[model samples]
Target: MTGPDSHRLVRSPGVGSVVIGPAADGSRRPDLVVAADDAIDWTVFDGLTVPAGYPWPRIIVYEGDDTGFFDWARRRPIGTFEWRPSSAHVVDATGANINRLWIGLRTAPLHLTVPSMPHGVLTVNGDLSLLTAVLADGGACPAVDFQPDTLPAADAVPLRLPDLPAFAGAQHVTVTVRPLRQAFDCASLLQFPDTRHLSLGGQLVNVAALAQLRHLRGLQLRFCPDLTGLPALDSWPELTHLIAFNVEEATGKRLRGELRRPGREWERSGVSQLRRPEWFATEYGLPFSGWPAAKAKKATTAYRTAQRAIATATGPDGVEAAIRAFVAVVNAMPGIETTEREDAGDAVAQLAEDTPFGDLTEDAQDWFDDARDF
Candidate 1:
């Protein structure tokens, strides 16, 4: 394609092909068409000029370094752009709406200034302090996904946005931390009452404070194994989706009961309830009783042997055999405690000569429940 200078724009044969010129309407419309490449010489589009009154492209998807692209684009009158930078030094999002900013740098910190953009979504995979600084500088972005490069310091110094009030209109926010660390508290987000969706992962312990946000509609808590408390569901009448994974056992049970409470208006609101099983059998090992045939053979044998000894044998030798058999059955079970084994032994010894084997079996089964504290 021909440029304003009458020079032919170089069109590479491969993916990095360039197309720049006037449209079929014969207007002096400038189009810097460059493909993504490992060795993209951005200077190829230099010196190109657009005719006045020509409609500029509103959305520019950039996938390479920000060498001179921002400066070049800022000079033009564009509306918005989606920047997916693999490696960039600094982004000057001063006057455009960066709809989606994906920082793919795995190690280095991303530095950017967001003086505008009332509606923007930022996804950073490096040091999150850059985002905090941007927000501190009056950047009015509405959505952010912050995944820090390393864990926060152990002093409980959470990552905070002192100027979060600047973006009080934010609707969505997501924070993920690796190795499951509590890098922040819920209080930091109290100002964003307009937030409709929120997701938090890692060691967030207590989320009961979030009940204050009555506008929240969707909440997801993941990998927060230390989390033990939740806000009342009635507070967030607009909430329709609640999901939690790997939370504390007590908290899971409480949430399950609360979300499924009969006759509650919130429960009738069709809020989806999901919970991980809180039973010891699912968490640690197989259930002492009701185990599948392949897994319960040894326990079954011990139980049957104990019943036979209690029913057919007589005197102290029979009582001893029955106690030993019961102890074997208890030992075969998982998470069995010493006190439970002793209790089962005592119960078996109490079996009298005329005692029904059925009664003795019931007593032994009761000890299994005590072993797991169920």
Candidate 2:
């Protein structure tokens, strides 16, 4: 065992460093220990091999980050990857070829291009923009896990994940990217020749989609919000282990019926937290004109101001202060009508709900009513 900072890195085409140690056969054997404390490129293992009559290299990662190291090792010439970190892993020189290809990595100080594999069961943990790329492109996988943004890109058209050949023969494929609000064409998934288990997460999908993939036995939907497509659940005889997360109640019931389930099999967190305050602000009411226009401006301004305050608010008191200010502004709006009051209160309440304010206080509505005049 060595201090965290003292571990030397091994990035070589051959056994970088070998330690002659005990053998299970009661003889001394040179054990190859490739350890690194700094970030190494994915290509570091491109030409790495183990000589005959010697065991595969044992990698000890004390402080190095691996990006796309898992999938690259799962392509062919199959080797088992434990996927655990900060420990010794005997990596087969030829790497792994299995049905399920798990793609995830520890943090990287410097990320390298992920090599493309011909095909198989795919799982996504980070940036999967690679799903949108051509399979033969050599390099696929998003360079960065694009920040999960809360602000609604109101006018921006959401990106659609296109169908690619990488998924055609894959038996089990999992791709979930929810915070980014990307969509995928469900109909094209039918083209997948032999898909059995499918998991789609953190993206927009038509609730009534994914019905045609007949051999599908397991389906896990996570953080998929949109329900916009032709509604039909293909009844696959082998169907089992179908579940979902963050789905609306109505949508869940619909999904249950489609999947032919008895009880509620899906659940939701009912939270859509955004990072930007502008994401919550929306123009209240229909085209404002005359007195209504001025009043609306004041109210909306106060709401936006309150949102910004809440977004930057450091503590419970800060959030309370922001809410207090909002209630005060709503109370002062000149001759504020019931409709205006309701709309402004709704907006402010929604903003607060998006934050942890509800969890911070008991009976938030009572507090809002006590502070609000209208």
Candidate 3:
């Protein structure tokens, strides 16, 4: 092969710089051998030829790295070739409708990117170290980017890549923004009609615009502390999981209220007092101060828990520590256990006696009376 830069040896048609020649030691080069189309005939074969029409079969070879292999196969469009020492095969795919894939099962470093693969199972025989796949927008292929890191050894699982259309068609959609941030607008992405799982981890994003996702299910805002507050999630009734770690009180409130129901079931680990305190109030509302004594008891539980954590800590301010120790001592000095709340229903009923009360209204008060007894 001769080019503008230099001259190289070659013997194949349309295949440049790929040829068999003599070595410096006068030995023949078997590394560049080309075999017949159906020549599964060779004993120690490293490469093979595919006569036009048929799909490439699996190839098991003994080559170390598959970098050059993929380059040659993609360029030559040959049939499957199996090097020595490897049980896996190689394939040369063509056309947009191609599906079948033959992934080698060695620890060799292979680098190739396929935008789309047709509907089929692409099996990998071994661990795919540092493997990456990126699909285009609206790319058509029922392919699942299966990352089965936990598959048992000697177990070959044929992972079918998930369909992009199927994911896009759901009531929730997730997107990675590292690559498409420049080409696509973040605001436009948030406006996806049915998108829900917006995981903007380590990606440049606009937190406020996310409110446009009316059907959002889960929002993962990991390591995005610069995001001041969360958007109002009342618009997104379907939102369930708020996977934010360090969100401020304002943002946390919105997330808690949207993802959790008010009152007892809503309380969770690290729940801020600002968000749902009313849920523990006497009026069955949050921000519990205005509520009855029952709500005060619930708030007292939280205060007691905080006190225990502080008490268990090693170092404390001298004055505050003394006060806490004194309080603990006073608590240990408990004397009596019984105290009953003045039942308001009885008092209200006694007052109702002064007015003209019907029997039905009295019976309704009896229902309240029964609730208090329970």
Best by lDDT: 1
The TM-score obtained by model 2 is: 0.40
TM-score (C-alpha) between model 3 and the true structure: 0.28
Cand. 3 Cα-lDDT:
0.36
Clashing pairs in model 1, backbone N/Cα/C closer than 3 A: none
Best by TM-score: 1
Model 3, range 183-226, lDDT digits (tens) per residue?
Answer: 11245453245664565532233556677777776666532323
Segments of candidate 3 deviating more than 4 angstroms: 1-185, 203-205, 257-260, 263-374
lDDT of 1 by residue, 274-300 (tens): 334343213212222334454356544
Candidate 1 achieves a global lDDT of 0.51
Question: What tens digits encode model 2's per-residue C-alpha lDDT throughout 130-204?
Answer: 333233343332111122222233234544444454445566665544333344445545656577777665445
Residue 20 of model 2, lDDT score? 21
- The C-alpha RMSD of each candidate to the native structure, in angstroms, is 20.5, 18.0, 27.9
At residue 283, what lDDT does model 3 achieve? 27
Ranking by TM-score: 1, 2, 3
Name the candidate, 1 or 2, with the larger lDDT value.
1
> What local lDDT does model 3 show for residue 333?
27
Ranking by lDDT: 1, 2, 3
Each candidate structure's TM-score, on Cα atoms with residue i matched to residue i, is 0.46, 0.40, 0.28
